[model samples]
Structures are given as C-alpha cells and as structure tokens.
Target: MQKLYSQGSRLDVSMPVIMGIVNTTPDSFSDGGDFFSTKHACDHADKLINAGAGIIDIGGESTRPGAALVTEEQELARVIPVIEYVSRHHDVWISIDTSKPAVMAAAIAAGAHMINDVRALTEPGALAMAAQLQVPVCLMHMQGQPQNMQANPEYENIIHDILTFFKARIAACIAAGISFDNLVLDPGFGFGKTLTHNYQILAQLAQFAVLDRPLLIGLSRKSMIGQLLNRDVEERLIGSVSAALIACQHGANIIRVHDVAETMDMLKVWQMTQTQMIKQN
Candidate 1:
C-alpha cells in the first residue's frame, strides 16, 4: 500500500483511486466547454464525488496538443472560484492542475490539496512554490511545450528516458525542501508521444514503481485512445475506462480520468476479482 500525505489529509493508494477531471478551461480535449463556469464546474465536481471519485482534479488551462496558453490572471479567475466552492462544500481532496507558480500558490491558498503540474515543477519558481505549499505534488514528464509537444518527439529509449527524467525531478524536489513522500510521478501519456510511445509506456508502467513513489496515470479520453479505437471524444468512454483498468492492473496508484462513475465501477469489479483470486491462491 502507498500513502500520500497532503496538508493534513492521507490518501491510501493500496487500490487504484479515481481522480475525476474538471477542466475549467474551454479548450481541454474533452469536456472542455462543459464546465467552464464556476457553478457548472462545482456542480460537475459534486456529481463526480457522488459517483465515487476520491479526488477532483481542476485544470484552468488546457494542455492539449497545439493548445494556446492563457494568461495567469485568466487562469486564476477560472479555477480559484471553482476550487473555493468545492473545497467549502466537500470533504474530498482537490487537486489543482497547473504549472504556474502563482496559480499554484493561489490555488493552495484557495483550498487545493495537491499540485498536478505537467511541466514537472520545472517552470520558473514552481519547485520552490510547491515546497513552500507543503502539499503533495504530481510531477509529469513532457518532452516539450504543449503547443508543439507532439510535433516530432524523439527518444533513444522512451521508458529509460522517462525514468531518468523522474529521477532528476525527484532530486530537484528533495533539494527544494519537499519530502519524497509528498511526491507523485506521472508519465504524461499523449503529452508528447506517438501512439507507439504511449502504448509502450502503458505496457511498461510498472517500471516506474522503482522510484518508490505513487504513480498517477491520466489517459482519459486522450487522443491515444481515440486514435487507437477510431472513436470520437464523446465515444471514447469505454476505451478510457478500459485503459484506466489496464493502468490499474499495471500498478498505477491513481487513475486520473473523465468518466468517474464508470471507472469507479470497473475498479470495484477488478478489486473484487483480484481479492477472490488471492483467496484461491
């Protein structure tokens, strides 16, 4: 069992936990315009929690391929109100998905429990800000910026390179006064990889467990699933849930997803089957 300690909350990751996505941006690949407003975002978050989500991941800016960046003020205005509303109403963990230091600080102050940075805290002042916040931080690996990440990503060895990247980021986090236990690692599927690269990372995800930190897998409604199954964004719920189950089987600690209810149902079934198998063995 793996445990992640945030400000004063402890998350048990012995079984895969669902972190439901609530994109406050209008440009996220899936469900972008659905929750752009504070009331709608907060309402959607409540629905996710009712559907069995342990964490609500709120993102103000879209990191989708070729996505344009938004101003810090715009990003803050988009997410802070939603975060404040959800945190005030619910007892669940709220994760702010941003790489900007100011947004991270303001979100934490507004009641976000974790920082899910796609830049892996490498953005200016981000590492120090995360350390100062003293909350759990998820560091993701992206080969390049979102605007051109998928243009032509190259790597001598995908898994090796990602592992190396995580190791260095872990070292940086520690040096910045963040505890290793307060860290989570994400392989950034579809962030900068081809279909082959994304599948390879999924197949060898267990290799990341060597880092001795919790793993956060976010493949929900991503292009990797759509491209593989020949499905559209709204039609990829089955593929998204299937991919999430695969990640759980491969030792992922947290599955960040869009379809919370469906994913939670699958995880429950998988957990029951695994328990029965263990009993028989």
Candidate 2:
C-alpha cells in the first residue's frame, strides 16, 4: 500500500489514485476554455470529487507544447479562487500544478496539498520553496521548455536519461531538507517525446519504481493519444482510458487524467479483476 503525506492530510495510494485535471487556463491543449472561469473550475472540481477523483490538480497556466507562459500574478489570480473554493467546500486533496515558487507558496496558502511541477522544481528557488512548504512534491522529467520542447527533442537513451534525471532530482530534494517519502515521480509523457519515444517510456515505465517513490502518470488525452489514434482531443476518451489502464498495469500509482468518471469506472473494473484473479490463484 502506498500513502502520500500532504499538508495536514494523508492520501491513500494503495490503489491506483486518480488526479483529475482542472486546467484554469484558456489555452490548455485539451479542454482549454471549458473551465477557465473560477465558477466553472470549482464546479468541475465538485463533479470530479463525486466521480471518484483522489486529487484535484488545478493548473493556472497552460503548459501545453508551444504554449505561452503567464505571469505569477496572472497564475495566482487564475487558481487561488478555485483552490480556496475547493478546499472550503470539498474533502478532496488539491494539487497545484505549477513550477513557480511564488505560485506554489500562494496555492498552498490558499489550500493546495501537493505541488505537481512539469519542470520538476528546476526553477530558481523552487526546490527550496517546496522543501519549506513540505508538501508532497511530484518531480517530472521534461527534456526542454514547453515552447520548444517538441521542436526536435532528442535523448541519448530516453529511459536512461530520464532515470538519471530522476536520480539527481531525488537527491536534490532530499539535500534541500525535503523528506524522501514526500516525493513522487513523473516521466512527462508528450512533453518532449516523439510518438515512438512516448510509447517506449510507457512500455518500460516500471523501471522507475526502483526509485522507491510513488509514480504519477499523466497520459490523458495527450497528443500521443490523438496522434497515434488519429483522434481529436474531444474524441480521445476511449484511447485515454486505455492508456491509463496500461499505465496502472505498469505500476503507476497516481494516474492524472481529464476524464475522471470514465477513468474511475475503468479502474473499478481493473481492481475487481485483479482481486478475483488473486483469490483464484
């Protein structure tokens, strides 16, 4: 059984946990303008909680490939209200998806329980700030900045490089006074990988488990699904859920997704099947 200790709360991750995506930005790759408003975002959070989401990941800025960056002020304005509303109204854990130290501090103050950074706290002062906040921090592996990451991303060996990056980041987090148990790892699918590269990581994802941290996977309706399946963002629900189930089978602990209800249903089926198999054996 896996458990993540957050600020004043505990998240049971023994089963595959769902971190529902709530992008409050207007330019998100999928469902961009759908929840850009605080009311819409908060309402969506309510729906996600009811649909069996273990965590609500609220992102103020769009980190989609080739996406423009927002100011700290803009990010704060976009997410704080929603975080506060969710925290006030729901019993669910809130994860702030940002790499800015200021945004991390502000989100936690406004009621965020975890930090899900695409840049993995590589920003100046981010590591120290995360240590200070002492919340469960998910360190992701991105090859380059979002704007140009997909332009011509390359790796000597994709899995080996990512493993190296995670090792270094884990060390850095612990050295900065962050508890080893308070860390999570993400492979950053589609952030800087080609279609082949993405599948390679997915096939070998269990290798990351050797790091001894909870593995957080975000493969929901990403371009990898769209491009591979030749489907649009709105039409990738089935593909997204399929990939998510594959990731869970490969030992993913936290499955970050946009379709909470569908994903939850699939997880229920998977869990029950596994249980029945164990009993039979």
lDDT agreement with native, every candidate: 0.93, 0.94
Root-mean-square deviation of every model: 0.8, 0.8
Q: Could you say which candidate leads in lDDT? A: 2
Enumerate residue pairs that collide in model 2: none
lDDT (C-alpha) at residue 247 in model 1: 96
Instruction: Tell me how many residue pairs clash in candidate 1.
Output: 0
| Worst 10-residue lDDT window, candidate 1 | 1-10
Model 1 residue pairs with clashes: none
Q: Give the range where candidate 2 is weakest over 10 consecutive residues by summed lDDT.
A: 1-10
lDDT of 1 by residue, 1-281 (tens): 78887768888987889999999989888887899988899999999999999999999999999899999999999999999998899989999999999999999999999999999999899999988989999999999999999998999999999999999999999999999989999999998999999999999999998998999999999989999999999999999998888899999999998889999999999999999999999
lDDT tens digits, residue span 90-205, model 2: 98899999999999999999889999999989999999999999999999999889999999889999999999999999999999999998999999999899999999999999
Segments of candidate 2 deviating more than 4 angstroms: none
- Runs off by more than 4 Å, candidate 1: none
